[model samples]
Target: MKRLFYSSAIYTALGLLSGLFYREMSRANNFDGYSQLNVTHTHMLVLGTIMFLVFMLVEKNFSLTRHQKLFNWFFVTYHIGLLLTVAMQMTNGIMTIKGIEVSPAIAGMSGLGHIFLTVAFILFYILLNKSAFKNKK
Candidate 1:
């Protein structure tokens, strides 16, 4: 629980910082056109902060930690994915603003990050299911 809360708080800070970065960077560059920065803000808030808050609620009711292995794996994989995704996104956004050519590998790694998040969610749902049923039977 504390872990979840801390994670959410960290993400909240990160989300706000990312938003600021996007705004300041764009303003500096006089850039108002499309860029990956646009989505970085939303992704951090929605996926990083809010998603963990939702999971915290689930943990309170479901005792997700009862499945210790799943909980640990979910925690690690979720962070790895979110960090990778956001880092690559911000990198691409910065590259765009600086008129630097973007690399294909960055996008590919971002896709892999999404895959990690997907797997983490699957583990979370499984933990939720086990916690729900373990209490029943």
Candidate 2:
């Protein structure tokens, strides 16, 4: 139940952030626009928060094989990825507002963050599927 509560909180926060970020980007009025903020935000919400919680529920209801530790690692890595991506994006937005070009460093961070998340998702899938369809009786 506690896991569900935290997961719900993450989802709610993710939705709020998505709406707010979308509004900011729409208002920016950048005509040359194909920003990854929307994509990144969606990935964070779907993979980082939603998937993590789903795994938490599976962990709660299943008999796992040392998978608990891996799930914790997934949680850490996923959040780290999200934090890096979001910080880079928010910083880029600030720079855009200040009339400064986006920094290559931030771009690199966002890219690496994406990779971390990809790996995290793979691990999450492996952990969840290992016991998701097992016979209960």
Candidate 3:
């Protein structure tokens, strides 16, 4: 539970920082378009902050620590995915704004991040199902 709370708090701070970065970048004319940074901000808020906070609630109800390994994997993979995706978006957005071509590798990494996130969610679902069914008895 403490881990969940800490993770959620960290993500909340990151989300706020991402929003600020987006606004500052736009105001400075650093980007011709704000789409990628906008996506970063939104993703941070939704996936990083809100999702983790929701997971904290789930932890409270389900005692997710009982499945410690699965919970750790889910937490780690989700954050890694979030970080990878956001970092790629930031890099690509900044490069585009500076009249540089975005790298194919960066796009590939972003896709990989989504894959990690997908796997994490699948693990989370399994954890939830296990907890729920166990409690049904």
Candidate 4:
């Protein structure tokens, strides 16, 4: 529970910061159009903040400590994915705004982040299923 709360708090901070960044960057750029930075802000809020809050609530109900290792892995992997995706998105957005072309490798990094997130979600589902049925007679 502590771990969940801590993670959720960190993600909430990150999401808020990202939103501020997006707003400032857009204003600086004269609000010309959408950018990958916008995506970064939204993803951080939805996936990082909201999702982790939901996870924390679920933890309260399900007592995920029984699968400590799995929970730890899920937490680590999800954060890694979220960081990677947001970083790449910021890079891509900055480059786009500056009229620069993005390299294929950078684009590939974003895809890799998605893969990590997918794996984390799978682990989370397994954990949820196990915990949900653990005491069912």
Q: Which ten residues in a row have the lowest lDDT in candidate 3?
A: 29-38
| Model 1 lDDT per residue over 1-137, tens place | 99999999999999999999999999999998888998998999999899999999998988999888889999999999999999999999999998999999989999999999999989888888899888476
| Model 2 weakest 10-residue run by lDDT | 31-40
TM-score of 2: 0.66
Alpha-carbon local distance difference test for all models: 0.92, 0.67, 0.84, 0.85
Q: Which residue pairs show collisions in model 4?
A: none
Where is model 4 poorest over a 10-residue stretch in terms of lDDT?
25-34
Q: Which stretches of candidate 3 lie over 4 Å from their true place?
A: 30-32, 135-137
Using TM-score, rank the candidates from best to worst: 1, 3, 4, 2
On lDDT, the leading prediction is 1
- Give per-model TM-scores: 0.96, 0.66, 0.91, 0.90
Q: In model 2, what lDDT does residue 41 have?
A: 66
Model 1, which residues run further than 4 Å from truth?
135-137
lDDT for each residue of candidate 3 in 1-137, tens digit (9 for 90 to 100): 88777877887888788879878877787555646777787888888878888998888888777898988898899889889999999888777656778889989999999999999999999999888689586
- lDDT score, candidate 3: 0.84
Q: Which stretches of candidate 4 lie over 4 Å from their true place?
A: none
What value of lDDT does candidate 1 attain over all alpha carbons? 0.92
Ranking by lDDT: 1, 4, 3, 2
- State which candidate, 1 or 2, has the greater TM-score: 1
